[model samples]
Target: MTEIIDYGRFADRLAAPRPRWDLLREFQDEWGYTVPAGVDPWPKWSESEHHAYVRALHEEWTGEEEDPFQGVDRTLPVPKALDEWWDLPFNSFTYSPRLYWTNPEYPLTLRPDPSGYGVSEGLPEPNPFVEPGGDLRLCCFMAEYEYCNEWAYLASEAGHDDPRVLASVGEDGWVLQARSISEFFVLLAAVRLPSHFGWSVQLGDDDFPDGPPVRERIEAAYRPMGFQNWRELGADTALFGGPDVIVRHDTGMADFAVEISGRSRDALAATARTLGWTWDEDLVEPPRKDEESQ
Candidate 1:
């Protein structure tokens, strides 16, 4: 497996190596699960955990412990680049990227996402970018929305070794989401990790009406990760990092939207205080003393 690019500091929070990975390899040795490459994406679950996870899923649908990947056919040659993206593990159960890894052959084995767009509707097909009647194959990797799945992210099924990323915005048609699958993954991480992990605040144009002054304040509070590709917004998307979290500033179609996050309450408080944003959420709340905790 090749080293995953940070992609302007987007992927490090999601795909960076962790000390827990060593313990995961030990579990694989004990359970006979394939010990993934050192550089491969981290496993979302342990072998035993996955077995139970699969069983629960089967019980939900089949009321039986049937193998989902049974008799699956691999008609399309899976690209090495895509395989790497597929191997990376991330939380998907709720409004996140819940990856599908089963058999019974999901068509060309590319609809690895549970989105209705890929499995049920197959709405964006044959590649609209290609000339009419020209051959085009797409691999839908993920679909997400605030609630139901209404968007799709796909790539070329049989083209470029590391396919460029595409997105289907319901009826909005397809747009170039990223230059490569790796960049797409990091972009997803950059947006998702901040809101999901530390204490976060989402700001609007009012807060970031001016650019340089706001950026200078943020830069003073955190280290810069770098800008990433988010063409959907039609502007630059930059990310910054504190000791353990990320702050993303998006200047796109909707104008400026900045999210500041930190690993701990103290850190988040410090950041929010420095920015003079004391809205009195956990970000600014000091930890209670032991006696106050009761």
Candidate 2:
């Protein structure tokens, strides 16, 4: 087992002097979780192969016999912090790698789109739908929660190292999600890291009516992961992490419940036994009685 490390509080972790990407890399390394290939575009294919694939895809769609990549640049045209985060394995869950670069390469992800640069973005610039009249124009990282009708992005001018993360809710206007985009990425890791494992169990009071106190039971067996209360998403989460398991207590925007995920079904059952939470194992994944009835 990975030796335990106290990450302090979630908000303070974001505020610490460490660079945002560095903080994220450090935490992920310590979390001891295997990162599945759900996010990120590299590693799944060789660099040369990936570029060739993109070139072929562009040609397939645009049908320009003349190489559109001729004298074209493919390095992602983004800021430094953004570039660093892009280099991290399975970065922010929502960060879809743009087919665009600055002189910045990994931490050299996607080598220079072969030296000879052009005066174009290589691809068409996406129309920014945010801050219509202000300086907060959209750039590379635009986070839209399609299900909730809300979205956020790094709201800043071009070439900014890092910018504020702002999100919109039902026309109520943008709310401050984080002081900097990097912190926002950390917040994403808190949830996405566990979710990447592909199992989540939401438990309400009814699921464990006669069990010990919820927080007390959780604190005794697992390390409280101190995830930020995502008010913009209309939810606050109390997260706990332990050997091969992650449990989250969510309140607001819906019901007060806990979400649990484990590396395997056995791990889930073990966590359940420790916390006094139960579920119908015969069901597909482990569902609460409330959900089974629904």
Candidate 3:
């Protein structure tokens, strides 16, 4: 079992260092979280508050009545020719891999949970895709990679029991956690490629012979596909740029999540075929519990 710590207290500890403390305070102020040198006695907003804020943003976008129970559409608009895409293994519950290009008006909103939290639930099963004896597990991000890690740490400290939030050091010197997935998706959606240009796939620690092959195969696929460079796509923000799609392949687990850029649905489908992958059309659609009840 992973060690659990109180996130509020942890944040306070982080604030003890003068520089780190100032950084934490800035982060909290900028992001709207409360922070101090020590644990504050005040009660933080309940899960409902978090959920409600997300829901309100969604309602504003969709121009529909706010419903706390529904998910938010976090998809971003992208160019048509680039055909940027990502794929998720159907089995992984951590995230849905089959995002595609849609109408510009379709604003992506994240769905809120019962407590109004924006985080997705953990997968029902542990990942089996990481190679049995492999020491490293890699998760790449197109944007806000650091924040994703911070969020994972926060969730773990908050007494959440999800394995994805657990910090596990892999034998290959990689630290495995969950928040990377969400940040990667957000990065892909926000990247803006130059006209007729696409982004490249890059993974850290390419020194291993086993790693390059995967990168090569993905790169080879992109060359003929008419995708452009990532910089041309207007990834000026810290939370943007890098690979248009991020995939986490684990040898230990049989499951993975695919996050794609919202470029063009047809292009995304074509790219998936090149990689010998397929996506479920039904899963591509957003979740709707109300429709199922009827």
Highest TM-score scorer: 2
Residue-wise lDDT of candidate 3 within 138-253, one digit each (tens)? 21111122111111222222222212322222222122333323322222332311111221222222322342354344545432211121121112111211222322222232
Candidate RMSDs in Å, in order, are: 10.4, 10.6, 19.9
Considering only N, C-alpha and C atoms within 3 Å, which residue pairs clash in candidate 1? 69-103, 69-104, 92-97, 92-98
Candidate 1 residue 294 C-alpha distance from true site, Å: 29
lDDT tens per residue, model 1, 1-294: 122222234334334444322332332222122322333333422222333455587679977665433322245554455554444342221112222222111233233333222332333455556665543445644444221222223333444665666654444555667655555555554554445444566676466443456667776766555334444434446777655456666665435466766555555666666766646553332322222211
1-294: candidate 2 lDDT, tens digit per residue: 334343324445656687677777665555444344444444311233334565577768978753434432234245565656655664533233221111111212211123222111111133343344444333323322222323234323334676655544443444555566677667666665544433456677567778576777887877665444544356656667776677777665635567777655666777788888765655225322221111
lDDT for each candidate structure: 0.45, 0.49, 0.27
The number of residue pairs in model 3 that clash at the backbone is 40
lDDT comparing candidate 1 with the true structure: 0.45
- Measured by lDDT, the strongest candidate is 2
TM-score of every model? 0.49, 0.52, 0.23
Q: Where does the lowest 10-residue lDDT sum fall in candidate 2?
A: 99-108
